[model samples]
Target: MEASFTKVKGGALVLKGEKKKKHKKTKKRDRSGERDGEGGKKLKKNLEHEDMNKHGGWWQTTNLAHIVGPVALQFYNGAYMKALDNGKFVLGAPHDEGQGPEPEEILMAMKVGDGKFSLKSGFDKYLRLDKAARMVGVSDAVGAMEMFDPVWEDGKMAVLGPNGRFMSVDDEDFVVFDQDKVGPAQIIRIRSNREREDMKKTEIPEELRGNLYQVETKFVKKFQKFQDHKLRLNPNGVAELVEAKRGGNLHETLLDRREKMKSDRMCK
Candidate 1:
């Protein structure tokens, strides 16, 4: 995908894109702050305010094992999603850091129709999959990719993409890779190292051996081990995806970076 030139706003990279649709009003939330579904039935909010304060901010992994343990999301210069002109979004890292995510990284977690939410980026662009619906990107067009289902089963919260895959990352760059892209996929494992150490292998029930991990597949034995992360809401109410492991040499695959640079050159 072709990348669009970014404008530096307050010394931060701000992606330029089509304007976002102005919301007439925020979604109607019950007294408990729960949003209602299309039928007007109350649906659970992803992260309660209490949880947000305790955990930090949106889509951040606060699992005990991740916080002080070996596993942590790599936050090099702080990561944020950037959309390219060719219809692909890159999770750009090595960005300037101050307090939290930059204004451009703050995404609006709008309650679109149904119980799902659409992420509207600071560029006023909606995050959606490509025309083929395989790769994810931000666009002005409002399509299926913009709409994502919030799956909070097994004591975990995950955003189901348009391709029916959950947002996940592999050993590769911070760019999200669809777990279900190939076969049976694992969602997330939300257990701290201490919790895992406290549990007795035999004493723990087969079902609850770990804190909370999900596998969605039938007859597929092999699945990728994914760490569950929580999405936190900033004071401004914008949500940002956090990582499990922090500080990773700010690794950006040369191939991927080259492709993006090529796109940028073409854009000029």
Candidate 2:
């Protein structure tokens, strides 16, 4: 498909056009501390509080192995899903230099369960630099330690973009890339003084006073692909028959495959 933009909001994203099928724009906020671990409004509310405190990034300075050993005991006791979500999030951190790992090369590993029969590191799987490369069209079989940095330990979180490019509005300079054309994209960092002042007009409800990370980083490559063909007169949206790169022969491709699948199954 063509390039499409994915908009990341507090907890989810809002996509455009065809791929925008089920994009979620905002999150339902909740208040009140959680007690009995459960789902629904109360749990959501408690998680919101924790989220505000956590702010998405939750890499701890303490030894991960030690934390995993003890926390497993109270898996359900006083456990909050919000913390778990933050704790379980995936991020790509580079390997520090000589002493630690190369900033952009090292892989971080975190265990999920607790001691005595708990799960191993959280992101041990995506450590395959080869696999990560394939996902982003890279050819070199670089080791996980050589290629892309995984933000969320490894497998804890799922995001809609490639590594290294995405950044939150809170970054030091907060440069945003606004796609000017298909082949070329423009970086729009530093808003004007008036725009900065106008930002006050964007009032969030009292409940959503915590996050803006998820909303900002949604513009990465993955989302960009979706944005390309996401409507608004790209002209590339024209339906046509094209040859498959993997197989031989050209076949007619339907634009809305979702509807086509539904119709084929006669689920109407």
Candidate 3:
């Protein structure tokens, strides 16, 4: 090995032939990629949850008079009514808390008459009261035995079968219409996947549900006393209508706008 020379503080020469120690450079890990991946996964999960809630979440029906759609019946035992493959109906446990019922557990309720509904299963079979007094899913078409009347009282609901008996769940988890009166076993919660109807939307006329300008024009044509049918609109923008809509006073604001134009018949 070649000897190298080093000068000390006192001008003394020292042999420095040792090889230079090489150090391995450690590269820092890119945590931003992992963080982005995790954030993307969380966003996707949240979007999936919101989409599921849009069409699959359960909501208790406050009015039994209008129970006509896809629904699930939950018994007092925390089980949902389900249709079996063997032409029978049973109460099955939910998979998780706040989870909606499965496809087999969903029933299509058709309003047959006042307070009467016909429940059809996912198998396209109508639920009927068999001769054995058991609720079965074997009928293809709705008949007298398929008609059910839902009764709501004190925020509770009960199903009355064609035989004038209340539907109840047995110890074996089977559903039957053998009870004469509504009891704990007979009480059920009718849940639907449909969104609740907004009372405000109901109060607004169907034709007046467009933009503010369109609503104002329609109102002028409907309530204007002038025979010329000319629309007299306020020169000021519809900013007040937008605010009124958010405050649930859109109708009053529209009337005020029409009164300012002197075109409303009821303004006087």
Candidate 4:
């Protein structure tokens, strides 16, 4: 056996041994960008798209500031191939064989083209604003009437009508497609049933809070705090986008009357 000896700095006897090698630190790989089994497709990074795919199923809106709140875009009396009436589409959960939004009222809005949407109603009919832009009629044909241009502004969604105007509810609570001016009635809130259950009172903006005109007083306490959010759905009935916008001030009848009085006096 061969013996090895070493000397310390102080001249003290010390033994020499083999030096051990240092191993490099292993790095962790990021799997977020990894592709899934779905045809080697990578996951999307857009949060809105993800939210829309999660909660963008059946949606309804209640015009919190102007007309009725939670008014469903449903069919008339759950009939097939029937038109929608704003007066009949009041805010409430649909029941079996009752005056509420039925399966026919439940709609699936999908993006067919760039900024263009197509709506399928519960009645298995396509939604159309009619050639005259006066009614939300249904059509079996996929023509210009069935195509809608959805516009989002200030958190409110508006479906473009045939006349290039937005679909809005009138003061009479009737669904009308002849709103040239953008008002509270023109703002349609899109939300799912789960969203409505989870809706809180603080979601709505203070500026939009007050009282609902041409509606019951109970709705003020009932829906004032209920926040309306938009959900985007994927082709597989998943929500890919979810967002909330603070609606503007309420459209008050007193304010309109005051403005009318002022205009009348100014005419003198």
lDDT values, one for every candidate: 0.40, 0.25, 0.76, 0.43
TM-score of 2: 0.15
Evaluate model 1: give its lDDT. 0.40
The window of 10 residues in a row where model 2 has the poorest summed lDDT is 73-82
Best by lDDT: 3
Off by over 4 Å in 2: 1-5, 8-42, 45-126, 131-268
Positional deviation of residue 12's Cα in model 4 after best superposition, in angstroms: 74
Model 1 deviation from the true structure expressed as Cα RMSD, one decimal place: 30.0
Flag the better candidate by TM-score, 1 or 3.
3
The predictions' CA RMSDs to the true structure, in order, are 30.0, 26.5, 23.5, 30.4
- Which 10-residue span in candidate 3 carries the lowest summed lDDT? 1-10
* Backbone collisions counted per model: 19, 32, 0, 20
Which candidate achieves the best TM-score against the true structure? 3
Candidate 4 residue lDDT tens string, 1-268:
0011122345645458856544453222224223243324333324333533443333344332211122244322222222344313222332443233345345565555545666665555666664445445356756666676656544446667646777665455445577666655455545444344433345754534443332222323433332353221112211111111123322343234335544554697
Candidate 3, which segments miss by more than 4 Å at Cα?
1-56, 199-268
CA lDDT, candidate 1, residue 158: 47
Local lDDT at 99 for model 4: 32
- The superposed Cα distance between candidate 3 and the true structure at residue 119, in angstroms, equals 0.7
Q: Write the per-residue lDDT of candidate 2 for residues 1-268, one digit (tens) a residue.
A: 1133333346556465535344353232222223233456666656534532342212222133333221211001111111111222122232222222112222233343221112222323222212222121122223433232212221121111233332221122121222222221211111011112212357754422332222112212122233245422222322222332124321222223323533454673
